[model samples]
Target: MNFILYSDVNDSSISASLGRPEYSYYFVLKAYHPVLESLGRVHVAASVADVDVLYRQLLAAGEDSVFLSFTPPQKTPVDLQCPTICVVAWEFDSIPDEEWDSDPRQDWTQMLARHGRVITLSSHTANAIRRAMGEAFPVLVLPTPLWESFAAIRQQQLPTPVNPGTTLAIKGCIFDSRTLGLSADALIPVPLTPEEEAVLAAELEAARPPALTLKRRFVIARHYLRLWLLDAGRQQIEPVPRVKFLSNWYWEGVRDLLPDAVHDWLERRLRAICAAQPLPVAEPVPLNLPDTSSVVETRVDGVIYVSVFNPRDGRKNWHQLITAFCWAFRETSDATLVLKLTQNDLALYYSELMTLLAQLTPFACRVVVMHGYLDDAQYARLYQAASFYVNASRCEGLCLPLMEFMCSGKPAIAPDHTAMQDYIDDSVAFVVKSSEEPAIWPQDSRLIYRTLRHRPDWGSLKSAYERSYRMATTQPLDYRRMSEAAIERMQHYCGFSEVQMRLSNFFEPLPKVTDVASATDNASC
Candidate 1:
């Protein structure tokens, strides 16, 4: 019954490890440790090296143990004496085919089938695993547990709101071009190699030429025609004119006149043309940012919005979020965006982020980047100063910062997709609309990299900003209601009690290991 918790991010420096994967494991461990303690002894291994040590110790002592890994299965050691459990936060529907050869999870699945079980954050992921592994495979759904520690922090009164139309006060480290090698005062484009320049030029040229063909034109016409017909039909059912007789008659005649073979030909032609279009190439953008210091203790008068994420990951969609925010609030001087980026080397993505921000020039709204080291208290203060939490991510395994913000009684502007679907709703958040878009599986980059992820509609996000601004400024009652609902939902979904119950249920069905030697022998055999 002894459990050894293995997490790679555990060994990371506090500030650096604040990234999603690290802090996610940190919070889960915080929630599960006490519960597991009541069951038996619990030990933590922050790195592979630590896990190796624990594995050896357990083997030598012949102790009944379970290895619980908070990282991907591939990252877990293949050889272990005890039954292993991998907790993963996969955001995609399935692993890519190309990744099958290079992905660590390929071996990890075999390990799981032989001597372990899998735990996922959502049913969406559970379904995906079932699709990949098999319906009969054992995969448990364990949502990321909320941090109960926040209760003490939440007891503190919220900071008073700054006066309208004045600088909103934010106390944190500001990341800029200086964090990397570039000078903050200058707008220098990141130098591109000749090869990179050539690739960029090719991509730009490809984008410029219209790829549409005659078949594509026909396909587009057919699609629009179907949509028009559907709309007209819906209108015809309405009280006033449920039947647009003349229009419907004319369309029906046209549809009858065109043979199905002609439509099929058009479809094939369109497909052929689409298939010929060049594949999108990943090209680096030129980096630029306005002069700013590493530390920011500034004030803003408008409604403050906040979003925290690691810029290194594309799923965060930080670039799109910044662009949408700028476009939404460009002419307004009364709003500010506070981005609390969690990464070890701010310089690694400083240029890219600044370059993205630089594109939103001559804007009235201010963008404040919070980076550098932050203690728990400082982090909590950053959350307290924000009026709303914003996330424009393409997907999430389990967004901890968004959960933490909700737990602190703050309303969010986020899309109700992926893990967020578990808690976000109209009652608690400004739900942005989204559609499935092509993406790469974050893990197993070498495997089927082409996958699909939710793409939030930029227009919807822009409107969310506008609506949230109005709610924060003119509709205090509604805003407070949403804040309260957010806290309530977090408590119900992420509470320690709920997590403990789920864990208890999950473990109850497993056979108890009475003899470590016997279990190890069986597993080895």
Candidate 2:
């Protein structure tokens, strides 16, 4: 049968050391070539433009396929008379249904339903797709092709020698920010019911200020006041000059200096004061290079992804991560913690963090910071020779770096919250449940007041940190086993065969195609 085999993987020959760009080209070439050779004919395409060219070429030659694989998934494929197959190369699609109300699904179903055949990257996705599409959307599980085409493997280079105690590059970037050339929109205030508001008020009322925290509040207030004054001078604007006390740290310092009973009243007054774009005089300097992931590459004993992407992002912060031990020589004392930080406003907070690290000296000698932007290849080699990775953010969206760690078979530690829980579990990484308070009102590890009267013993936060440290240095780990398991899981759910089978079944029941052009113009709409 004639078919269109499509793949848009950026690098088909992506080395297994690299966790993405599909899993393995060897698997992909093996799966795709056999199908193409056995099929009567196959038109290979990557983009919609390529699709048009291929169709023209086929029509000019008076040839057609009973099947088609739209290279990239989720596009309205140019109307094809033949029952067309559309492939989506994502591991999981969190669609919005009752079960996934926060995700987007109806569009996914519509896109797939329109395509006579739909292919998914993993089994997890296939099941979800079927369930979301009323359990009857014509779909298949063709493993996401690892390689787009073919190539011979190159001799591997020696792993870069990491300076003992030199930090591995640990950076975070928003998933699509750099690629999208965008900054995150400021945090939107979540709505709370009156009952929830009352509870928060009570928590604040019951809370007592941690000692130095008062100084931090004043400092932050001075900060906002400075910005407010700057804008008032330059832009002729005014912002509220008061404070509100709160039990939260994420928005602490500036907001929590006021009494609890009138906190909301103060915030509303502040908003009224600084309604205009409160410019501190200029826009934040844009990062000069691509995000940290752009420079991500696997090293001999380690792999790294970088970028100072998010603060609330728990996935890449500083806590949850594991180490690689394909080699027996790695020692924790010899391991380094390389952190790339820019001194922008949010990153400036890291300056405070540096002071904190110096004061606490927790794991002092082993941690290293490379200030300013760094060389990618330089860091890639550092990562190759390093032991493991970790993040300390309190929240996150899709976590690519942690995935890179797991794909490498290294364990990781993450706060129990965040988007990371979606992929990693007990088998792959450690999830730490922690409270977000210390930075705001100050608290102990057990979600208790640090004072003797309220403080409790060991809590999830402390446990998570301990787990992170342990996994970060775990030697003699089974990188291959971890990597293999991840591969199997991904393949079972997202591999090319899984997608092809689903697509095949989906298209099998569709009316045979005389011509794709005619098919698109008629019947399926």
Candidate 3:
């Protein structure tokens, strides 16, 4: 059988598509390539249109062909001529069963029904589909085959509870909180004097569109006054200003016509009213660094906890990840948290991340932020440098990084929820606690809460950190046992031979037994 594969992202587009919805599908396709080749000749289609073209060529040569779409069911092409199977990675508890935005594909059940067969990265995702599509739905749970890829790293570097000191080199810039001079006060804006406030309000009034009416102007004034009173109340400022309460019914009707300037003014005024604060009128400054591709290095020692994530992705729950790490090891100078950011655009989360770090300041624990691509050597160095892998995500379809580290024999501090349920256990990880919460589908423009995602417990996560650090510092034998268990878990979960056998069985009755033998020599993993 000839296998044709396609994903929205590929090697050429991955850098630009980082943090895009479903961009990780590209990495999934890459991971499956060798395994697919082991079963039959594999061809990666550059575009969706090329899928059918390649399929026809193979068909004309008397070769059976199958198209593997590494994308969500909604994005997969329904018109393809060859047998198509969608490779989905979903973390939500329920799939969208209703249509929205006049797009019928929003209802995943319809798409999966039409596709006939589907492959998901986790049993959680498969169960979600089976729940909507019925238990008979042909959905296979096959995580990306990654265990074999890290064999060299696992062999070259044994897991150690404490790093002697390792220099991690990256092509992008590094930000250390110790060097950042983080100050929560820097995030606050300076209060405006009464005279300055009057001047600014007059300027805003002058800039208002000339068609503005007295009634609309009063509405804006009332809005700001309400805000001022609320701030005063929160700050416990005595002698609050008394303003007549207008019917919110009246305000709601007029709020739509309020100029954008009014909203902007309200934000500025609120920032300027935190009275008696001597802070500058600026938010935390975004990082200024050398070119992203410039080589930078940093050394990490002691008990190091590393986490990789796209900060812009809301499901990452990075706020808790950082804060918990800081609070857990506040007085421990040797504890370090290294965050390897996966997003290309730093501006998206820099200010907020810095502000969060600033709030947890005066702590001896270190926080290091590495932003850029790591070549193979650097990545392996990062892998071996970690004494433990950390993931405080709310949910995960399949956390490839966590699995990768585990495959390299580094244990984790993570939640055994969603996809993690299949592998994480007390034997291998310090399992954090989580609960379900309402969530909307990623593509749902309606923002209706029709699904459920995990909400990781912050206290549980902080406690896990403390416990893991204790294990790393005081219980070397126990840490080693957990490290070995981590590797064993990945080997069973994502090893090449096991994944290949599942894929082969899922796609039974390929052209001939010899066809598989013909491609055996060409398989890389």
Candidate 4:
């Protein structure tokens, strides 16, 4: 059989597509290529049109062919001539079953139905498809074969509860929290006192915007009142009862009296007035973060925990990962968090990360942010440097970084929800607790909440960090046991032989005859 694989991103474009919606498909496709070659000749098409062109050429030559689209179901071509199978990486509990954005394919059921079969990284994704399509839908859960790829790293670097020191080199920039001089006072100005507020209020009352009319002033006042009341209700700020009462009265009695257009116009004007006001503080002093395109090295020691992710991806939930780690080891000096960021645009996450670190000020535990690509040697060094892998993700579509680290024998601090449920457990990881919450499909332009995703409990994650730290410091034997279990789990879960066998069976002459339960041992999604 001739396997024609296609993804929107290729090696030439991967650097620019680092955090794109379907960028991971490139990595997934790369990992699947060698294994697919074992089954048959693999041809990677540059575009969707090329897929059918190649398929026809193979067909004319009297060769059986299949097109594997490494993308989400919504993006897969439904009008293709060749038999197509979408390789989906999904985290939600339900597949999109309704149409939106005037695109029929946005409803995944239509796309998957047209394709007739699907391949996904996790059992969660397969179950979601089955929920939307049917239990009889031919969906194969195929994780990227990765366990065998890290054999050299595993052999050279044995798992340990602590790292003496490891130098991590990257071609971009690195931010070490220890050297950042973080302080909440530097990021946020001090709150005004009641007396000072009274004086400022009088000055503000006398210096209103020149164009402010009585009606407009009332509108602006009402807007501020509503914002303050909402913030108060959310416990984000202190409440002023009089302002809350007035806002509630206006909302209940006056809001309905105004036409929506007028109300919206007033809100817009209010926003403009607010935007013109001076900020409480000037832009927090730039951290003067490293701005370089050359390789830089940093040394990390002690019980080093590492996590790799694109900060732009909301599913990563990196905010809690940092806070939980800092809070868990606020007084400890040995703990270090090495965040290997995959996104290329540093500006996207720089300020937000710095602000978060400042807010959680005075913590002794270190955080090292490496924002750039790592070559094979550097990446292997990173893999070897980790004492444990950390993931505080809200959800995952088969977290490849977490799996790769585990395959290299590093235990983890991760939530056992979504795709991680297949391999993460007490034996191999310090399981962080989570619960389902309503969420929208990532591609749904209408932003309709059609599915559920996990929300990792902050407290559970913090506790996991603390427990894992204690285990690393005091229980070497137990740590080694967990480390061994991590490797064993991956060997069963995504080892090359296991994944290759599953693929061979999936592509058999009478495909769909293979029992998924037996293939996956009823473990993965």
User: Model 1: runs farther than 4 Å from truth?
Assistant: 11-27, 46-63, 96-108, 158-172, 175-296, 445-450, 521-525
Predictions in order: lDDT? 0.69, 0.41, 0.85, 0.85
Query: Given candidate 1, what's the lDDT at residue 223?
Result: 65
TM-score for each of the candidates:
0.71, 0.44, 0.80, 0.80
Better of 2 and 3 by lDDT: 3
lDDT tens digits, residues 1-525, model 4? 889999999999998888887888899999999999999999999899898778667776767677899988877887766778889999999988889868887888888877778898999888988988889888899999999998998899679789988899999988999887889889767899999999999999988755545676577667767776676666535455454454544454456567888767766765432122333676766555677689999999999999999899998999999999999899999999999998888878888999999999898889999998888899999998898899999889999899999999999999999899989999999999999999988888888788899899999999999999999999999999999999999999988899999998888843321221222111111
lDDT (tens digit, per residue) of candidate 3 on 9-78? 9999997887887888999999999999999899999999998778667766778778899989888877
Better of 1 and 2 by TM-score: 1
* Deviating ranges (above 4 Å) for candidate 4: 190-289, 510-525
Tens digits of lDDT, candidate 2, 165-224: 333333433221112222122223568999999999999988966654667767765666
**Which sections of candidate 2 miss by over 4 Å?**
1-50, 59-86, 89-108, 142-386, 389-409, 412-425, 431-465, 468-512, 521-525
Better of 1 and 2 by lDDT: 1
Candidate 1 lDDT over residue span 1-525, tens digit each: 678897765545544576555466666665667867877689987565665567556656756567788767666665555566877777876643333665545544565555446778877788777876789777777776665767865677542223343232223356432233433335766789999999999999988845456665566566656766667666454433323332333333343455778645644764432122345898866545433334455554457788988888778988878888888887887688888777766558866776676656757776877765566666777667778889999898878788888888788999998888888999999999999977766655354446678999989999999898888888888887887888889888878788778777777776655554555532322
